[model samples]
Target: MNVVPDPITTQEQASKERENLLDFFARGLICTTARAVGADHGEPSEEALTKARAVADDYLAAYEEWLVKLTADNAAPGPQ
Candidate 1:
């Protein structure tokens, strides 16, 4: 039996995936920065975490913008 996925469910999955990516990126940045600064003892400092989140937000925004442009270009009609 073939089952078609609901559009809403697919959208939700994409949203969740983005959220997960943001988290992963932020965490990685935090760890990398901490190690570079020789502060990788335990948990990252509040300041480092904040900076990492900011960087992650900017990265995600740029990525989303590029994706939108790519999608729009692909959707445009070609020569008739």
Candidate 2:
């Protein structure tokens, strides 16, 4: 006989999956920035550096926004 999964366990698993995906994307952003700055024999051009900085800043802002939303969501009350 097959058993049904618990709702709480399912929710927790989904939450973990979301966190893992976010972490993966964050690492991707870091790697992209590193590649942009470390290109051309360990000396990227000024324009490349500037563009990389902008990209990094945007990524940071997005991360902060996500954190705020996550914090708010966690602080909210759940079902009784």
CA lDDT, every prediction? 0.81, 0.64
- Candidate 1: regions farther than 4 A off: 1-15, 37-39
TM-score of each: 0.65, 0.46
Residues 8-60 of candidate 2 have per-residue lDDT tens digits of 45778967755555555555555566878984344455665555556655776
Clashing pairs in 2: none
lDDT of each residue in 2-68, candidate 1, tens digit only? 9975554577798887777777888898778778999746776777677787899899999999999
Candidate 2: count of backbone clashes, pairs at least 3 residues apart or interchain? 0
Q: What is the lDDT of residue 21 in candidate 1?
A: 79
Best by lDDT: 1
